[model samples]
Target: MKIAFLYDAVYPYEKGGAQKRIWELARRLADDHDVHLYGMHYWDGPAVIEREGVTLHGVCEPRELYVDGRRSIPQAIAFALRVLPPLLREDFDVVDCQEFPYFPCFSGKLHELVRGSTLVITWYEVWDDYWYEYLGRKGLFGKAVERATLRLADTIVPISEYIAADLRELGRTAGLEVVENGVDFERLQEIPAADADWDVIYVGRLSEHKNVDLLLEAIATATTQLDRDLSCGIIGDGPEREQLEADAADLGVEDQVEFLGFVEADADVIGNIKATSVFVLPSIREGFPNTILEANACGVPSIVVDHAENGSTAVVEDGVTGFITEVSSEAIADRIVDCLTDDDLLADLSAGAKAFGRDHDWNVIVDELEEVYSSVVQRER
Candidate 1:
């Protein structure tokens, strides 16, 4: 079968959960079927190139994904416009488009209408009420766009059940299939652990919704409660890095926290995770966090916050792979202390975490995606 994936950003070029998912699925599917990717050109060469047997077509020049700590509307519009012409020229069995930014999905719909291809929108998060939190009065426009995009796809593949529930609430009960995010478990096992070991680590963008500030506060409280030196490693860079660093200093945990800004290599990120005793994802909102699976693959149990918008809690088994606490610094600090203080409990969780990670390997995920694509194409026919 011929498959095409549509998204504004490409993996390795721009690191994110959705980008990684498309890259992994596309490359693996390319092993058996013809696969192509469409996105902004983050490279220096031609507009089209081949990597790992998958064809990548750069629809436009790369643009800054964000402005003033929020997603850039102009950039999204630019990609949405540029993508249609290239997409209209090709016809494939399946064209799976990412559902964020909400413009390119319309292009995919147009392509499906003109070219007679199956359109699959890989839906991530459903903002709904959170739109007001993000855009104030202008959220009405965002909400309208989201609702319209929900109807564009022949099939909608949600990354988690939380998102599926959101779609149902918005009256999109039909054609919704849940396919969760995955990790490269085999690749993680090959990378050696980093030399320095951290008592706790957090890997992801330092964005506002990530609640990383809460992580620092939790670390400070945990340090005092433990009555010993606790080292924390933060990997990744974003708008909130400076403020988070300042927060750490103000809390007097600067010495205990090391801000390792954006390690480009996956091996390095996984290596650091492997060296950590515990992983913490304090984010209040998440469609699906690939980092949680990566951390579990490295035998590091994760601590996630229990929030309505945080769909990542589904992937973590509460007492087995990790612990889920309320969205508070004190609750997070308590979980951190629980994992750090008890060696036997930590060891047990580590074993369970690895087992959990093995179950969500990228190979298994791609297999499920292949079935979804085939079913969609057959239904369209």
Candidate 2:
């Protein structure tokens, strides 16, 4: 079978959950099927290259579809217009499109019509009410467009039950499957653990939506209340880096926080996760953070705030894998202090997290995905 994946960003190039998902799926599928990736040239590279049985085709130039961790919808629409000519010329058995930069999927749908290929929309999560939270007044238009896309999808693959619920709420009645994200266990195990220098670590973009300020406040409060040497590693860069740095100083915990900007996933990120006592991400929204899966693979438990829309909280089994805190610094701080101070509880959670990660290996995930792809193809037949 021939499979074509449509997504703008590729992992390690643009660095996000969606990027990682597309990269992982394309490579894994390549071993068994003819796989080709249709994405923007976010990094310096040839227009076409083959690696690990997967062929990558750069449909657009670097920074053409995105800017500063945000999607320019209008540019995305223009990009779709530019992509349509070449995209319609190709034929595949199955075409999987990422839900973001949503306009391009219309072209994929046209490909399905012209070639009789199955069209599958890989939905990480739906931005329902979050449009307002993330974009203030202009979010109304964003929400409308999002719903319109959902209604047009031929098949929707949601990553979590939380996302599945959002689709049902939007009146989507069929062609949906919930496939959880997985970790690269082999890669993580290859790297030796660094010295456990960090008491807590938070990886990912330091954006407003991530609520890194809340993380800083919690780290400060936990350190003050404990009266001991407690330090955190903030790994990743974003628009909020300067403000978060100032937040640490303003809260008088400048010495306790280290902002290590954008370490490569295969290198420093894995080592850091193995070395940390706890992983924390207080984001108000998420589809299922790949970072959490990576932390668990490294035997590091996490403390993530509970957001009903964000299915990431579902991965945390409260006292078992990690604690789920309310959306407040005080609640998060209390849990951090408890985990850092209690060796027995921390050890138990770490063991549990690793066990949980083992259950969702990429091999197992791809097996399920293959089944989905075959089923979709059969339905078309």
Candidate 3:
């Protein structure tokens, strides 16, 4: 099969959920199929190159798509203007486009229809009310555009049931499918464990929707109540860094927290996770976090907030693999303290988390993706 992936950023150069998902699938599928990626050239290398068995076409250079740490809709419009023409001429058995930076989806859908190729829109999550949380009044318009894109695809592939439900609400249940996110167990198993240097760690983008302020407050409260300085390692960079740092200072937890901005090396990132007593992500919204799965693979348990609108709660077994607490600093702080002080509970959760990680290995996920691609192609005929 000839597969084409339309996403404007490549892995490592601009790492995020969509980039990781597309790159992983492309590289692995290239083993038995002709896989090609079309995206903006964020790297300073050749416009066309092959890596990990897949071919990549750097269509255009990335523009300033970020405004105040969030993706600006205007930038997406610019990307679509540049990406559409180059992508229209290409023909493939199937073409999958990331649902974010949504303007390109309209053109990609038209291309697929005109070429008689199977079109699949890969959605990690639906913004829903998060539009208001992130974009204020403009979010309403964003939500409308998002729904329009969701309806344009011949097939919709959401990463979680929670996202699939959102699509259903948008009247897109006919050909919707759920393909869960996964972690690389083979690489994770090779990561050597390190001594616990930090009591807690949080990795990924430090953005508004991530609710990192709540995490800082919880860390401060945990440190004060425990009568001991609780060390925390925060990995990743974003527009929220300065605000988060200010938050830690205001809460008198600056000395207790280490803001390690964006660990670029995978080994270093794995080392930080393994060296922590517990991992936590107080994100107010998520589809299916690969960070949780990665930590689970490292035999590390995590604590996540039970977001009302998203399916982050579905990822954990509540009191087994990880604690799913209410979205509050006090609740999160209590769970963190329990995990740190109670060695028996931590050990049990660690075992459960590791067991869960085995079920969502990358190999298993790739096999499922292959099946989905084949089915979609067959149905297109």
Best by TM-score: 1
Q: Highest lDDT, which number?
A: 1
Candidate 2 C-alpha error for residue 354, in Å: 0.3
lDDT of model 1 at position 219: 93
What is candidate 2's TM-score against the reference?
0.96
Cα lDDT listed for each candidate: 0.92, 0.84, 0.85
* Per-candidate TM-score against the hidden true structure: 0.99, 0.96, 0.96
lDDT of 2 at 265: 53
Q: How many pairs in model 2 have backbone atoms within 3 A of each other, for residues 3 or more apart or on separate chains, i.e. clashes?
A: 0
Candidate 2: residue 39 Cα off by (Å): 0.7
Give the Å shift of residue 10 in candidate 3.
Answer: 0.8
Alpha carbon RMSD to native, model 3: 1.6
RMSD of each: 0.9, 1.6, 1.6
- Identify the superior model by lDDT, candidate 1 or candidate 3: 1
Q: Model 2 Cα displacement at 233 (Å)? A: 0.3
How many clashing pairs does model 3 include?
A: 1
